[model samples]
Target: MLARLGAISLSLSMILLLSMNYGSFALVGFLSATGLIALVVLHPWTARLTDRHGQGKVTAAAAGIAALSYAAFLACAHWKAPAWTLFPAYALAMGSSPNVSGMVRRRWAHLHDGSTRRAANAVEQVADELCFLSGPILATILVTSVFPEAGVLASGVLLVTGMLLFAGQRRTEPPADPAAGRRESSPLRRPSVWAVLMPYALVGILFGALDVTTVKHTTSMDSRSAAGVLLSMIALGSAISGLAFGKVRPRSEPRVPFIVSVAALAVLTCVPLAAARLLPDSLPAIGAAMFAVGIGTAPVIILGTSIVQACVPEARLNEALVWPSSAITGGNATGNALTGWIVDHAGDSSGYWVPVVVGPAALLAAYAGLALHRRTDDDCVAAEDVGV
Candidate 1:
């Protein structure tokens, strides 16, 4: 998940900047969108590979492909190569991401059960928050202190080293499942899978828009430097809550936690808008709102993923896990593009509404999942009962 953050947050701006240098801002947007699209399109393939070949081998191979893509990127930047090469380089690299978060969650499911798995998920969520909180800062420092390509290079190295080390932990790896290949049909056909995925995509939109909107909002207040700081506070709040959440065993099934967390998230997501309206000049107020939003975010993810772990077939676990992330990527891209437009025309303050509107969409998705779970209660058992 930490490594995934580097790709999502760190190398992202670097890729955009490199693309912009190659051609126009249109190229930048195009590549960024294409990279995300490629992730959605190619992610299922990686899941299939992971399930069939084992996580270690697939991850190692994917990291290698990503490394080579970065190498191509470096060569292009060095020689000032054609701008078009950037497309393939980025597509190949992002397409080869290996769904690190999904793999980690799968392992957690493999090793733990019930409240322990929930606790483990919480721990992973905390790690995820820390990664987002620290990864971008690290990348920014490296880029500014070293070179333009420094962040990408560092990420590439980390990708290789980290995946290699992670892959080496054979005892922790999930065994290859032959059943994953039995059905050439995708997991998208499963209503249970899509129920979780649809809302997650909505949540992803909230995430992506929240990011771009925060930057715009901070810049509008002439405190652009505090944007990252404010965002870090948000992540900090989530990490703290994640720790607390892990310790307490929820009295209900995963669905209840999922619904409540998302409902809280939907409401808390509006706080930023209120802050923007009421204290237009106060970045701190906006930060406070972001912190609240963060608090709700982790539990939603933790419970949602726990439910997904329980709901999907063990053989198709990798594919099931990747769907939510893919939906997130797709939704994030949608939110960024849409909010960017809103920020340009409607104004920065209006950008907050993007998340506001999308938050309920996420809630609706959660409710859909709950409804589906009610209808097919037997299908949605505890993770331990599923015995993946």
Candidate 2:
């Protein structure tokens, strides 16, 4: 959660600085995409290193590099460096920051299995929502009240501190096998891998679009200040539901979480879409509907993490884990661009359609991969044993 908070806060600050320097939203989008692209491209290699070396060793080293990269990026921005320099510097900073949330989840899987793991996943999801809830607000406050570069500087400190603290937990850290990558083939070869990741990516679409639409909705309503309140409803509902969802033991059926959450999402995502039409100008109605939709969001994530854990060899788990995140990052970028265009051309309310469409696509992906999900039982099983 600290990693998420730091990464997001830093992204927001850099975005603001870029906006100040360039005065072009297009350039802001480009730089943001560059950072995300570096994450998607570089994380697999880092995860592989984590599997081969150790989480503490690998993440600590990477975080150190990330902190230095952040320093360089900030220096460049502060000195009013040329427009093109920001993209590469920001990309390095983003790519080098450890995916600490993934590492933490990896640790949870190391500690628990079955129902206990489910509960742990819930806690992580709650923490994640809380980070999302607060990170942007924190960044906005620091940038506005303190200084233009204060947000960037603070986020770097938090990230390095979080990684160092997490790394120091030597007793609980998972043992890294130096030869695992050599012995086990890459998890990327499994066709069912995409099956597992695609649904989650669709979930990302729902979330990414939800955020953009929420802000746009507030803007259209002529109450831009209420945007944070509306988004808080969604995050608050998800966090509450996540705590409750963890207590409900999932049945033995393998596809239960995968199929069920997507189905719920398919139905629940429509609530906001419906509210946008039925109560066009009612912020209370929209906020209430958003909270309702948020109720179904966390389970999809909680179980989704569990499903990923079940679907790959423990030896290759870290690398396999990065794929879902890559998929989500890409999906979020897609959802943002797609919905932003709609908000600009059609209407702010029309932005909800992207999620509505994305929900059923996820459902289809869930069912389409049921056989694969059911057969993927023990993560420790040899990678070669997972049949195509």
Candidate 3:
């Protein structure tokens, strides 16, 4: 949660500063996407090293690199650096950060199984929402009260502190398995993998578009400061629903729930567009819309994560888990860039369509995953019964 707090804080926290520096929404989008691209580039490699070396050593090293990157960011802010310098530093900051959240999920999978693991994942999903729940609010307070650089600086401190403590828990850590490194096939070879990750990427788009859209909308109302609080409303709804959703164990495969949740997400996402159009002057209405839209978030996420966990081999678990995250990163980059462009061209409220448009694609991907998983499961079940 701390790790996600640091990562999520970046865009909103430094947003005003980036606007001051670049003076263009498009540039901000490019820079944000660039940073996420760096993260995507490093994910697979980081997972491989974590598998080969051990989570503690690899996470510690990544955290250290992230610290240095933050230091570089601090230096740039001090000097009032140009976009060229700030862009790369921000990219490095994002790229170098450890996959602490991913590590946590992998650990959960390592430590638990079956329904226990599902419940654990559900709880962890709530925790993930909590990180996001507080992250933006914290970033807003620090940036508004302290300084623009405070958010990234705080992120650095939290990243270093949390990762070190987490790594110290040696007994719970998944043991290093160098032998699995010799496997000939890659998890990427499976089509089901794409089925899972594609929706994740779509979900990423939802988040990214929502981030920029809310901020821009609030900014339009001359309440830019309230952006964090409004965003938190969305997170609050997700966390609340997540707690309730976590209690009920699904009696069947997650396919139906996953698809239904994704479908709900796509439909609810359109509410913001309506709110923006009808209640242009009403912040309360807009906030309610955001909260309503957020209801579908945790269910889609928890189900997706659990399904993906079930799909992959234990040996490649870390790597497999990281892929959904990377897909989200990639989707975020795309969403940010696209929505940023819309804000620049169309207007902040019109930018609401970005998520609306992406929603169906996400739903379609979830449906495809449900179909693929069922087919594969049926094939396996048939073979097993015949063998018996």
Give me the candidate number with maximum lDDT: 3
lDDT of the structure predicted as candidate 3: 0.79
- Model 1 clashing-pair count: 0
- Give the per-residue lDDT of model 1 (tens digit) for 2-92: 4656664543444334533563433444566667788988988889889988998887777778788878866776576787877787777
Higher-scoring candidate on lDDT, 1 or 3: 3
Write model 3 residue lDDT over 1-388, tens digit each, in one string: 5667777777777675566445677877887888888889888888878887899888878878888888997788667777688788888888887677778888988887766777787788778778777888888888768877787678778777787777787999998888766872465765556767878899888878887888788878988778788788788889888888888776656668788888999999998889999998788888888898778888887877776677666777788788888999999988888888889889978778888899999998888877777766622222111111
Model 3 TM-score (2 dp): 0.94
Steric clash pairs (candidate 3): none
Better of 2 and 3 by TM-score: 3
Q: lDDT at 301 for candidate 2? A: 74
lDDT of 2 at 223: 68
User: Could you tell me the lDDT of residue 243 within candidate 2?
Assistant: 87
lDDT of 2 by residue, 1-388 (tens): 5667887677566655665566554455556667777888898899999988999898778878988999999998888888798878888998997678888888877877766766787898899878766776676567666877888988898888888888778898889988998898787666457566878778777766776677667767776556556766777788889989877775444356668877987898888889989999999988898788788888777766666676666888888778887777767666655665677667878889988888899898878777665554443332222210
lDDT of 1: 0.75
Instruction: Report, for every candidate in turn, its global Cα lDDT versus the true structure.
Output: 0.75, 0.75, 0.79
